[model samples]
Target: MKVIILAAGYGTRLFKDLKNDRNEQFKHLIGVPKPLLPIGERPLISYWVEALKVRDDISDIFVVTNNHYHHKFKEWAQKYPFVTLINDGTSSNEERLGAVSCLQLAIDKFQINDHVLVIGGDTLFYEDFHLHNVIGQFETIVKDNNYANLVLSYPCKDEETRKYGILETDENHKVTALREKPSPTDTASRQACPCFYVLSKDSLTCVQTFLDEKKNAPIEEKDAPGHLLSWLVGRNPVHVYPVSGRFDVGNLESYITCHKYFQQNIRNIPTYLQ
Candidate 1:
């Protein structure tokens, strides 16, 4: 499986909390991009990269980000032989493709047709983050000519349903409904997407086909992936696997707290390179 990490966004929420000290997600956390920010001397994304290495199933790693940070990412890429960094040529969200579009861009650039794993650069799965389990579940769903898509979600019960993409699943774990940042009253399930998703090549092809048709039209929806997933659920089989133990790094409080929490508890954190 190939990995595509969406790291292109400007992270406005994080910047607001930093009080305009800096806008880059990596830089603001530790005077670098959010991926490069150090947690107890180890770069924040380093942990995930290392975990991916351990899995052995993932062969290639790609990070999609703006051209401005290419140099910084190049420095990090040199340290990992399996990593390839691509510039999205976007300095703002207005120009950048939404999450699904970004992955489509990666698919076009890399010509990836295998099962691909898409992760949010802002979130980290703990060592026991239910990812491998979810992957196994996904394989089963797609095995017998079944669903073409599966998303790993988490239970969001902290009165913050509106801040996440919530899921409603059937008895068979198939996704029946999707709500992106739903109002409290509209929320049907506590499961929120924590950014871990497995997409079959067929599923991505369908998404790309839809995007091609939608590009000429105005963007009626804000969250591209959420909207796409909702649409896919109706036409194709889509499953939601519940994942536990992840922090939403997009939020200021969670950002600071994850850094401190991982620093004190995570044993695999590597030494930060100077």
Candidate 2:
């Protein structure tokens, strides 16, 4: 399997927060990319690199970034010879390719033909998250059907449903539908879907197909990766692996919360780098 980290986003929310803050300590972080921001002792994306480096299943690791931060990512990636950083050729959010488009770009640029594990650069899970467990689940499902794809989900508050991709799963945990930021009254299921996905080789082609179908639609409909998954549920078999929780570092407050949690529980969090 190949791993793709989506890191091309401009991080407008986090950048804005840092720029307007009066705190002098955080002033240096104003222009840093979200994925490169320090979580504890290492960058946010380094946690994933350290974890996946121990897994033999992953053949190649690719990080997709924008032109503005490409040089920074390249310099950081120099220490890790295994990683290859791809520039999406967009300097700002307005010109940036959406998440789905970036995924497609990575696939095309790398010529990946194996099962791909796609992860969000700015997100991490709690101590309960195990990559082996997720890969095991995917292997089991593929035994019955090679085209099956796996995604991660966790329970969230009812009011927070609008902040994530709400998933409606059946008794067997097969995703019936995926609603991107649905209203609170729309569904009773509070399973919030994260950007972590294990896409089968057959399902990778569907990424381009989904983009073609949405060529004429609004940008918002195709921007988030959740929208692509929402469209794939009906055409492919999508399964969910429920986890404890995840930390989405969107703003300064959320970043601090995740940093503190990782710092306080450093021993429990597996890095495999040691």
Candidate 2 structure quality by residue, lDDT tens digits, 24-132: 6688887789999998878999999998988889899999999999999988898899998999999988887899999999999878899999999999987777898
- Please give each candidate's TM-score: 0.87, 0.97
Which runs of model 2 end up more than 4 angstroms from their true locations?
268-274
Checking candidate 1 for backbone clashes, the offending pairs are 25-34, 26-32, 26-33, 26-34, 27-32, 27-33
Against the unseen true structure, what C-alpha lDDT does each candidate score? 0.72, 0.90
Residue 213 lDDT, candidate 2, scale 0-100: 94
| Candidate 1 residue lDDT tens string, 1-274 | 8889877766667766666545544444532566765665567677668767667777788888776566787898788878878788876646766777777789999999788888877777655564467677778878865446788777677588887778888898888888888887886688887766788766778768778767775554523467777767777887776656576677567777888887787765442111
Check candidate 2 and list the clashing pairs. none
Superposed Cα RMSD, model 1: 3.9
Lowest lDDT block of 10, candidate 2: 265-274
Per lDDT, the best of the predicted structures is 2
